[model samples]
Target chain A: MTRWGMVIDVGRCIGCQACTVACKVENLSPVDAWYAPVVEYEVGEYPDARMSYLPTLCNHCTDAPCVTACPSGALRRRDDGIVLADEDRCIGSRACMAACPYGALHLFEEASGEVLGDGSRGRPSLLEPYTAAGRIPGTVSKCTYCAHRIDFGTANGLMPGVDPLATPVCVVTCPAECRIFGDLDDPDSRVSRYTAERGPREVLRPDAQTGATTAYVGLS
Target chain B: MSAPVTAAPLPQNVFMDRWVLGPKTQRVWGLNHAIWFTLMGIGGGVFLVGRAFDVTTELGRVLGLPLVDVVSFVLIAIGGVVLIADLGRPLQAWRAFRNVKASWISWGAWADLVFLTFGGLLMLPDLEIGDSTPFSGLGWESEADGAGSVMLVLASIAAVVVMLYAGAVLARPRSIPYWHSVAVPFQFLASSLAMATATVLVLVVLDGDDVTSGQAVTLAVLSAALAVSMLLHLTTDKEAPGKKESIDRLVRGSSRTTFLFVSLLAGTALPALLALVAAAAGGARNALVVVALPLLVVGGFLLRLDTLKAGIYPPVTMPSVPARRTRG
Candidate 1:
């Protein structure tokens, strides 16, 4: 019922990868994997040219194609409408990866020299210790809206505490506060109010009918 | 030079004799190519089994037996073994799971594994149980009652994935136009089915068993439908650059014409006609069905081999154009 989503005000984005870095630190994601990527595109030519930066992550669509494409049921949507991955159930099929339109999912692989207690090395680990343990080899991963933290906060009837290490490093590190994440169901939430005041455009991939929940605002 | 006439300097053509084909061409035809061919062949075998099952289910009474499953399972097993053995690091194949984001080849391997496992379960009942006469009404103790049904469903799903994987792998961004279309997957699926039916027909004949006239006719009809669909898909659209080129290559026979025409048409069509004639004679036409089987098998293999070799690289222009222009 909580419908987790993000509102990226592209007008405010400066193309600096603060959100990207924050995401890496908060998620404890691999050095190469960026849970939130800010893609820069230049239009026109020379002096008259203009540039725009679009930050993209899991769209968490109402009809997520990745969900249907998964053969092992590893990818699922929670009761609160947050799409998440259950690493243990993943068989490493990658069907969901192929199905993703936004290229949001990052297939996590183990870093070199990082060995598990079971003697397995080079397996994927989320940078944050709390989420790292759930990473598995041959499996796909994507944004979870910090569901673990969100659940904890909900239980205590308080604002979700950012893991001193994980509180969505991207949201905290944003120099321009371009990326905003919150419960879309909460009328007073920043993301909800922003969407109501200035509607944002959702990124749509050709041939994919999934209606993405993540929206970008002020991109003409 | 003529005036000097010093043995005419022993013709420079001698240098031509030392020239050998380039390694790139050889590599294209080497082990990796063989693996591709072998995969297609195995796919053909699976197609045959599916066809045989369809035929037997429709005409078992006429044939006085349902032997299609028996023959199909054998061909499928043989093909599966060939594919698995062809893997470069067959032992360490489990490592394919390292990157799910970038690889469907790995997923294909897993699908094949599931297919083989479930296929074996389905075969046990046919091989060990031997007809319903002995194990009749065993009250849930029967093989058919337990793992057999479950395995059948699993194998069916895996088979669908197996059919689709070839197209999905080739449909990556910027690949040749021929392999880019959504229709490509369906095309592969159809062709594989046609090829598989043909393979089963051949094996059935080799087993010294005759297919019923009705069953043969049905299979022939399906084969014809598959052939027609293959042609239509190859010719209809010219939008996707990769797909158009692939279709052109298939039609012109530059690389795979011989395989496509001779093997697919000659092998499939000849037997299919025989089957049609046999069907017209009611259930008495066993001879024609026998003759059509081997042709179908060979034709199916040819179809698979051609499709696999008609490989296309991704569009490198946008990504690598600057380097090429500089070199030029």
Candidate 2:
């Protein structure tokens, strides 16, 4: 009964992108891939208009369309609610990309552009040495929710939402303390507590019926 | 270490359409999809029509292969090649067969293979080329007759799947409101049949054969159906956020080609009207039927092209920011 989830206080987010940078450093994501990107938009008109920063990442929905649309069996959702794509099994059909509602998926399209050149650093983009499924060109990728960290930390007797090592870097790195992560199944967990006390159950696009683990607060 | 990523701010002006987090047009499938869908539909359509009309056996070949069967097979083969080439990893394209139970594209892949294999074997012993004269086939013709019936049945099933599969693929992404309709698959099937029927009509005309009273009526009905399907597809999803924008995109935006050609002239009206006239004219070889046949096919292609262009990504709802943040 350990369903991993994250909640964001939209009002507190300062759009500093520290978490965005941390994700890149931690995950070694492919070039042009924003596993966690804060999308900035100007909402409302004139006097009522305000700049809004919506931090977007993979929702890791319980009923994920990408997992279903994957013809090559590349995308899979774990029992803990973490969804990740198998780089080796992917056929680069782009079906998962079209299927994803959050646009979480990214394809490392070309080896020449994504790889580090000059032969000194013989690498095809950055590698996630933690997971057996390494990065490759023409395969899709997305936020792993730092599953490697959560796995290591929990196996060694650490709570994910409470432990810096176990929590997602986006939550750990946010300067404004905008994000919270915990086991949603545990009613006493921070994510659960926050939702019960203050957080709105409405995730983005509640219409999609994605059963998205990520929820938000401070919306009209 | 990965490169330090730059922040991408949404263009303020472009948001004029919806103002908040706006709909993004899906950029994944484009001209390649259009080509694949159109050709595949036409191919499948031709196979269905040719079989339904029982032209496979009546039309003869020196090598014992009917032209209709061979043409349909080649068209689908070309479509399959184009689709595979468009994939990011064409080298591992064979891996598409891994998930036939879930993915429509996988269904298409398997369907294409079966259609080609069974359809290839099913291509008939037909008449001499350029004339109605039935040619006696080579020695094994008598032995091939029984198995050909079973092959025909299998290929027909595969052909129907091929015609419907791409639309099913588009419809699976529920976030894309424009494509998330039963109407899309319906429209795809309709236009596919129309295109296939039009192709058959064109072939019949070119072969100096009289336009059959049955075929002319079928063309009129299918042509009208294509138009009606387009209208239903555009009208029914009026309430969805992306759908209005999709309509605009089709009518005036990048997909105007579809509105002007497919919806208005080629695919629908001209063909429908002319087919009716030709049918009324007692299947006469007329200039209008000749002109409308190609246009009918073009409209079908345009529908596929424009529908892809018009696919608007569902706009994400902005969390209601407090009043203090609204100042421009």
Candidate 1: what is its chain A TM-score?
0.81
Task: List, residue by residue over B19-75, the lDDT tens digit for candidate 2.
Answer: 236678888789999999989998998989876765644544345466677778889
Scored by DockQ, the top model is 2
Docking class of 2: acceptable
> What TM-score against the true fold does each predicted structure earn?
0.58, 0.87
- For residues A158-194, what per-residue lDDT tens digits would candidate 1 score against the true structure? 5532332323446657789777767777878777777
lDDT of 2 by residue, A119-157 (tens): 244453344432334567778889999998899899999
Fnat of every candidate, listed in order: 0.00, 0.52
Clashing pairs in 2: A48-B326, A49-B326, A219-B320, A220-B320, B59-B126, B59-B127, B60-B126, B60-B127
lDDT score for residue A179 of model 1: 70
In model 1, state the lDDT of residue B148. 56
